[model samples]
Target: MTDARDPIVRIEGVTKAFGSFTALHEMNLSIASGEFVTFLGPSGCGKSTTLRILGGFETPNTGRVILDGQDVTALPPNKRNVNMVFQDYALFPNMTVRRNIAFGLELKGMGKAAIAARISELASFLELTAYLDRRPDQLSGGQRQRVALARALAPDPALLLLDEPLGALDAKLRGQVQVELKAIQRRTNKTFFFVTHDQEEALTMSDRIVVMNKGRIEQDGTPEDLYFRPASRFVAEFIGETNLLTGQAIGRDQDVTGFDWQGNRLRAIASPGVGATATTASLRPERVQVAQERPGTDNAVQGRVVNRLFKGHRMLLDVAVGNTVIQAYTDTDRGRAIEDGPVWLGWNANSLTLLAD
Candidate 1:
């Protein structure tokens, strides 16, 4: 059993460079045992590079990688206790699902019966028992991905690295697989290090999320932490839909910090060193309540509804406040009642996050 309190993987001041370009800049991260940690960022943000280094496919230019209690920075791919599930579902084309899953066990020279048992166990766990005899080309994308997962999990490695493993599936299939993957992780109780550029995927699947930008870790926290209390402007904008308003911090009263935006006074949660500094407030679209009459809130703004988009259960309204546009979401009935006209948007102080500019 994996110890939840122990650090399964510790990346200490790791840096990677490709000639003049630096891919990772003194990156430091610690992943707990049996935790589902996702490295989230856009392309060229060093998420994949970090995964590659962890998998022993690429050597870091500096620092050390400690797996469990030992330093495995210099270890080769085969010598390390980590397995990777690639984006393309890298399964042998000629082999059946059974053979594909048993490939690693066969290499380890396990008894034929033992290898068969392992494959059977993994297939059953991943819901692939029905497709055990099928080839890679004969199965659907989701099935093939499951087979690939079974192959990786058959050897029972200490950590599983998933590099955009669901990138090939369609939107609906991807959602289905995501739930299955999380269930499988819980059932196996193994450390998972997932890398992806999709923010929703990261939020939905991670125990903790490490958001990267320009080869550096911008923020690392739970999905709720990143969404509700973003540390930086990049994190505020990257993690989800948010309205950013640039203002000058005027003063503070206990836990409330006041800011001056365009001629309006706005208050947010207390900010450290907020007095006299330029600050930005991040408000989620759903947090802003829209109505014809002014609502009871710490802050209220009057604006003209520029556009309204019906999104099934909810309606998205683009309201223009001064020169900036604020996006707000409301129930379909309430939204249609106040469509394309002047409206008042209000939000409580707790909903507004004050960020350093």
Candidate 2:
């Protein structure tokens, strides 16, 4: 029996390059069984390259690929217990959903009876029972995506690599599929190695996200951990919208640091890797509360509303405080912040996360 706690996949010292340009550095990461991990980054950030390496489409210049405790660096895609679902799904045009799913099983030399049973099981599991006999052309984008997933999962691979599987769907369908994919991963308990540049997709579907940049892993942690407690400036800005405040540290008390931003005294908790003399912090727009009356918080600042954008339930206000402009997203009914209107921005000390220079 496989222990779910043990790392089923481990990429150790993996490095890949094309000619003089190196793509992946000495990357090392371990993924536990049944965990959903996402390689999230922009284009040319080595996320796709890393996924290709795992699927045997690209060979690493140096490193070992471990699958289920065995070093499979030399193994081909077929030899390794790994399957990939691509952006286009790559489903066969001539075959029905049944044959498409059974293709991998038949390649494994499974009997007809076993393949049929597996197909039935997966069709029901993926809600494709009604479309099992349809060809790829007859199905919708979401249906085709499900078919591709069923086909990939039919092999019962130890790991599934999804390369932007929802990229083909429309915006609304993409969001819907994100939730479905996450639910399917949870239901199947299959370890997923997902690669996508869509931050929202990564945030919504991943149990953990590995933020990559410049051919290297920038930050690796849970969604909340990376979003709320980023370890670096790259992570703070990449994961979501943030206000990178440049300030001077005047003093410290425990984990909290007294910060001076445009002469506004603010208190923020310092994160690891933040030097004592560092002058930067990451504050989310939603953390800034706007009101006419000054909030009784440890940190407060006065500003004039320079711009306001109505976004359904909330409003985004650009407030100008002296020479600095701070963006704050508050409830639509919180207070009226019109252009050139005086507004008070307040937040607790814990809202600011100090960034390391």
Candidate 3:
């Protein structure tokens, strides 16, 4: 793995416009070599635009793009030392698997024997050794994807770009291939710039995530940081399931603040420079505890049972208090015979996160 500060690709004040509308603002970011970074968001959040800019498919209207200390802003896609895997797995229908994997090497003027050797090496690594002579149409979706990946890696590019590469796979196969892709990246020590709209996929595979909205970055951090310490309400609501508590600041100190929601009062620890005037709080579903008896805390509240869902390993409870709904997660092993009899909801001091902006 590469150090986070040692950037291999840097974008400075990069902006893109489509005639009148701006697709990307003056954005700036850095991706380290050998880092598995993902650009994650909903559709039309400029995630695809950023990927296209990095892949040399689109030029930014302003600012520069640097790759490995070299300026590549005006370079065409073929000149940039990067490879991209598309969502459709663009394989040659007439070529065999071996030829598809060796196509890049052939284009680079490598000897036929060397190309064959490299193709064999890559096929073995991807466990496609037995399907070398089969065409893409003769192989399964996962096999064709592996062949596409092998072809992209044959040239040993400095960066690999994946644009929803696994979107075409079935859900069960997608999960299986995610494990395989992570393993391949680890074994090869390659830098990956992946784009995906699936939040769970981003959380599962990325070393760091950049969440974008409206052509600008909303939050950039590790999965744990985004999940546990969201910097804004947009991040708190977008990255995961969160119960928003409308509250008003009651008291403030250097490192703590008190908030009042309805008749419930809660204290949350904040940074030294943070203020107590925050108007909202983000409570994660896992942080809320549900029980038949109260835990004797200042954060406890009384709510009526609106719905209960029994998942395989956990139970999801939706409780309504006034106009607000609180979601609580209870493990299945915690006894399920309690019914809807007087539910008590509580969360610890650390679970309450103040949100602003």
Best by TM-score: 2
TM-score against truth, every candidate:
0.96, 0.97, 0.94
lDDT tens per residue, model 1, 147-262: 98899988889999999999999999999999989988998989999999999999999999999999999888899988988877888998999999988778878888887888
Per-residue lDDT tens digits of candidate 3, residues 1-357? 235368989999999999998989999999988889999888999999999999999999999999988899999989999999999989999999988888888888999999988988998899999999999999988898899999999999889999999999999999989988988999998899999999889899999999999999988899988787776788888888999888887896655578888877787654223366778888898888887888765488888777888888998888888789888888876637557746788887678878764
Candidate 2 lDDT trough over 10 residues, lowest sum: 331-340
Candidate 1: stretches off by over 4 Å: 270-276
Report residue 107 deviation for candidate 1 (angstroms): 1.5
Worst 10 residues of 1 by lDDT: 270-279
**Scored by Cα lDDT, where does model 1 land?**
0.91
Error of 1 at 354 (Å): 1.7
Winner by TM-score between candidate 3 and candidate 1: 1
| TM-score preference between candidates 1 and 2, better one | 2
Q: Can you give the lDDT of residue 246 in candidate 3?
A: 88
Decreasing TM-score order of the candidates: 2, 1, 3
- Candidate 3: minimum summed lDDT over ten consecutive residues — where? 267-276
> Regarding TM-score, does 2 or 3 come out ahead?
2
Superior candidate under lDDT, 2 versus 3: 2
